[model samples]
Target: MSALAPAVPRRTPLDSFAGTWHLTRFMLRRDRVRLTVWTVSLLALYAYFVTALSALYPAAEDRQGRAALMEQPASIFLGGPNYGLDDYTIGAMFANEMTLWMIGLLGVMNMFEVVRNTRAEEESGRAEMVRSGAVGRHAAVAASLLTVVFANVVFALLGSALLITAGGLAVADTFALSTAIAVTGLVFAAVALVTSQLTTHGRGATGLGLAVLGFAVLVRGIGDLQAEPGEHGTWLSWLSPIAWAQQMRAYVDLRWWPLALSVVAILVLLALGAFLASKRDFDGALLTGGSGRAEAPSMLSNPLAMSWRQQRIALFWWFLGTFVMFGATGTYLGEGVEDMVDDIAGSNPEAAKMFGDDPLTGFLAIMILYAALAAAGYAIATTLRAKNEEADGRLDITLAKPVSRGRWFAAHLAVVAFGAFVLTMISGALALWAGALVNGEVELATFLKGGAAFLPAVAVFMALTAALYAWVPKITPVVWALFAFTAITGMFGPLFDLPDAVAGISPIWWVGRYPQEPIEPSHMIGLSVVAAVLLVAAFVGFRRRDITS
Candidate 1:
């Protein structure tokens, strides 16, 4: 009896990682469609860019000229740092044209994926149910990270293979380039994991991660824009994970040390997230930011008003980014519009045509298109809120009251449509004012015309999203797919040599290139008609469909 002493529990490295593999499989099963679609689509897009570039710039001089133009300030701001721009190969052009944008896109995808699997599940109460079993505290986070890493690896292998074999890129350059892209995505994935631990709401977690991304892009742009040609040091690009990918200089020097910096950052973030997860309760957030208002306001009594209240924060961020980032673009172009326009025209004939006579107005036109896309994104997210609410069993309570399906749905659609209109105007006005201030002239008419040009396109997307929400609620995510298809085709169609028939499917294509070309009143009228039809159909469908929880 005396010899029977206290026993210590034995733990191994695997103990901390217990259930990670099973959880990973479960997450994969849950998100298979999403994961597969994202991976294949991204890889195909990357491959298309590489393949198209080789055909577009078959001549060596053509490649060199395009590469030099990429070194311009506007290019660096629009596309991240263009490494190896002097190299006479498609790989270098691909690095310049696609790397930064791809990094940003992949960062966003990683953020949403990590947050959806971790914080979103926890918020929805599914995570607690899973954790109640034999799952370890760290398993969910670990599984999410590992799954993302695996996806990135798959993307790198497929993307690099395409570049090497199809595009005839040097093996070393392709390897380095692909690794840089993968590592950039991993950094954001880790950031999302840390954010998921800190924020109670999944949207907050996403916003925190994207805010970091925005800050990094801004720092890298400012740093590179100011640094002298072939200059280094004292620039914030050295500190941005996105910039670190370009600093690797895939085709030129194949510098790999910057990746070590990313590795260090990722490890530190993962460790911090694990520690925080262990310290907090199962469903608790480390940063709750206190409670909301004790009672609902009178304004919130209306479904339309409530929708606005729910979406105001997201709209605020979009408006801020559009105002600052797009406005900064205008400011940069204003310093020497003629030179910038000529440089851009020399590189891209389609852009030259789109910009037309007044370079400022032309630039504003391009910004308007981007702003319209952002507005569409806001609308899509807002429309999808119905799905979220329904899944959370909140929609039933509202429906059980006096709320008619049509009225409730119409209220959401109205809010989304109205918000997009306001945000687009705000973005356009700010960009116009900034550009005017720099050029020593202000033209309110130009701002109004340019900003209003894309509203029809934005409305079409909003209406499309509403239709999806009404008729095919289960496949509402496909609206994003449609949006992506249009965005990719519209943005890269010329470069990729895609047929007009294929590119014409996007509503963006219908928004005739403005300022350079006259606005098409007939086309705008048609878009408006289409939007109205979609909304009417959506309302009818919503009334007849079963509202599921």
Candidate 2:
């Protein structure tokens, strides 16, 4: 006690990280429901697709035949690169089908930080307290990365187990398939991790991540297309991280090194992000936050404008999805339904009328169906804004003002309308652009024509979402559930011999199968009537509701 004690160091790793364990526990608690849902949903999708692939391409010859048929520009863009489709290569089928779509969706979902460290923390001011503790600059970042890594590991293990349990495929193929999907998930996890670091806000993080995700898809698609023509586009695909992860092909021609690339890239990004945090002041960003307006802008003067401002980014994504689907990847991929019609016509030519040869009508119908689905995504997202407002407490204070309940409802409706309108154009436009790009055909009318066809069908999703939000406010996530069911069914249902009753349940089914070009007057009539009825009901029901806990 008499001896002078050595001067204590100003900081230690444990002091700075003491709250990390607590933060990890908190992150787990918040994300359990979300993690469960994401894992289960992915499992269901995995099972359905594995079954579909096993059945549809049972032999090496079948795989080759399918690959040959995938030559259509729409098919190339949407279904992705198929490596000759050998039975051993069934893993590639899953890779081509699920990798980009799942990764992009999951990447965006994980990056939003809607659960832990960002928006939710901001909403509750939990972040301020956590920082006030002995936490270091990198604790939050480390905690968030740890959470995402845990989620990806869980997802991988769960997926591997389900693929094994799902049965039918060869054991080797099953492992390969699961590995490919897991790698895809891991790639997205890395992407989302880096994205969360760069933005000051959750939405911004999501936007940055999705933009990368979208670019990954486009790069892969373009690279694949170029490679087929014996060009350097294959080099382009090689440049993309997604293409690298996918080339592993688990069961066939496995390239293990790409996983290393993802790991290295993710680690480097994490280090950079952590280093930035160490240098910056606490609660600060490497990039400065933009100054908020001194007074509210005139554009945000109304409830509708406020709604639009909040969701404009979401609208942009929906628009992109719609247009891309329409052009070549999405709506155009729907064109693949026509590929089997030759076999169908040979067996029963009558079935070919809607599902028939002469791909023009079938292709158009596919385009419309895609257009509707893309539009629905936007509609559901736009309608969900109401829930977000109330949950965030924005609605409570706004309603306390002179704004009438009806005006408040009406303002959000206006955003839905504008977003929905742009969404329609986007669906048509992206499809047109992709198709034109690959085909080297850029006539203005042709582009306009391609984009124009999807407008009416997409309007239906907006109306349907509005209806759901109106009738049931608390259960807002139901729209996503509905979309999931419809999407899974639309994708693999036909291959599994799904019952008409099951298929009919999706409003997307009523929009008519597209790229088949079966645009019946009755289909348009049905779509319009359904949209009108739902919208009227939503407005009516919303008008009668009161606020709740």
Candidate 3:
């Protein structure tokens, strides 16, 4: 008689998705406010940019002239693959101005969304508690991915609906363009989930994911530059998720293969992330470095120095990235931009606005703001580190030492300001070096001087954020909102036709257009004074407030 073979029970998809519904609901409830803000902000910005650009180039002839300018190296360096420019419509114009960057914005949104729900929960010990119940190992990950994917889908539908109202655009084209964007978001969200499984800390996961996003965008830009004249596709573009959407040529040919590639990539990344998550223990990382020295070094005695020590790794990475970005922008935007601008400027005077009246001057002006924006991000992240530590209970331990509340708070703010200065200097130097190399007639000193003109604005953001953290610790996340408000006002204020005084509220606006325009010494002095006042307020408020748990 043959022994009866034991049958292994098969698990359905529901088994893997166990507890995902409740988790998804919880995540949606938790993120509803953030989602609303992101959606509203993006929609508003899109409407403004689309409306402004459409008004600027309303006629087909104007659109064609604008499209010709886009073929220039300056345009290629900034915007990827000017599709449908031959018979360009208002919709195509909107896509040309907004698509690549919108993809980047959505990528960032998806990354933070995934990291917050997955690694952040795990790092804070909430994942363990949730998983101890009926939650499957992959439930949280599933819920997070679901929430972000749903958000992406909703945003895409809403954006496409807005695009339809632009007139002269085919409905199919708008749908395709929005689909491409949604797919790009999905791929990066998957990248974040994979990164979350690899790092024990949420910040590490966010950093790694952002690094990948930045590199992908760089590759896409290079590929766009290298694409042969009259060619629509490049092999280099195929390697980047950012370029896949552009490759779809949504408003042009509506190619489907590249989008299929994105979908496949998303599936593979999700599966790999789930596998990694299943193999690791909760709160454990697949990759880790050695622990710090048991005994504190003599140099660690100072609170400011300790803040630097703690933030050094993140600052180093950010500094390196800023250096690369500025250097590349300077090299690409230095010489050839003038010839290209001149060629198109005769046909469309509006080209001057895009390039800021003069090619080299405009490039430098834009690069200055770009560098300041990068520094602002560093400042905000560093400023919020103190609040994050306090939430983790590490602030109490440090305060239990010989440190006073005011001194401890002041040290963090000082470290952020100093770090922002160092990062700004690095970006400025690298930009000057590259610009000098490309524009052989330009002096390095002049370039450096022009780049340094924007640093005071960066400092103002740091001080303002520090003040908010000190007085309203619970609303520290609002710093990002503040940064967004500043960026939109400064960058798009002219396009949006805001009142001069309203635009002047942004510190970057006060910096003046450098190299093209002289530095406003009064503006610089005023910004410094503003920073000082904010710091004094922060010190006072921090001293009086109770430490947040």
Model 1: residues >4 Å from true position, as ranges? Answer: 1-9, 60-72, 78-81, 85-89, 233-235, 291-293, 331-335, 343-367, 428-433, 436-444, 492-504
What is candidate 2's TM-score against the reference?
0.82
Error of 2 at 197 (Å): 3.9
TM, every model: 0.89, 0.82, 0.89
lDDT (C-alpha) at residue 429 in model 3:
54
- For model 2, the run of ten residues with the poorest summed lDDT: 344-353
Model 2 residue 347 CA deviation (Å) reads 8.5
Better of 1 and 2 by TM-score: 1
Q: Residues 1-549, candidate 2, lDDT per residue (tens digit)?
A: 599989987876666556677777788788788777877787777777666666655666556545555656656665556553434356666666666666665565566543246534643567878778776655666676677667767766767766666644446655654554455555555565555556566566667777877888888787887765533247778767676656665555665666676667667766665565566554444566678778888777677777777778787787776666566643333334445535433443222333446544443444444555666677777777787777777788888887887788777877777776666555554555455455344334433443344444456666667767777765666778878877766544444456888887776666445434334667667778877787788778877876643
Query: Tens digit of lDDT per residue, candidate 1, span 1-549?
Result: 577878988987677778999999988888888888888988888887777676657766667756665665657775566666656577767876688778888888888899999999999899899888888878898899888888889888998998888889889889888888888898999999999988888989999999998888888888778777777423577878878888887776788898898899899988888888887887788897757789878787788887778777877777777776667555544444556555655565555444555655566666666767777788788778878888788889888877778777878778777878877777755564575467556666666676687888788888888888888888887788889887776555545566778776788887765665688898889888998999888888888888886
Better of 2 and 3 by lDDT: 3
* Root-mean-square deviation of every model: 3.3, 4.5, 3.8
lDDT (10s digit) by residue, model 3, range 305-424: 888888887887777767766765566454555665455444555545655666557656666677778889889878888888988999999999898998888778777887788777
Candidate 3 C-alpha error for residue 235, in Å: 3.2
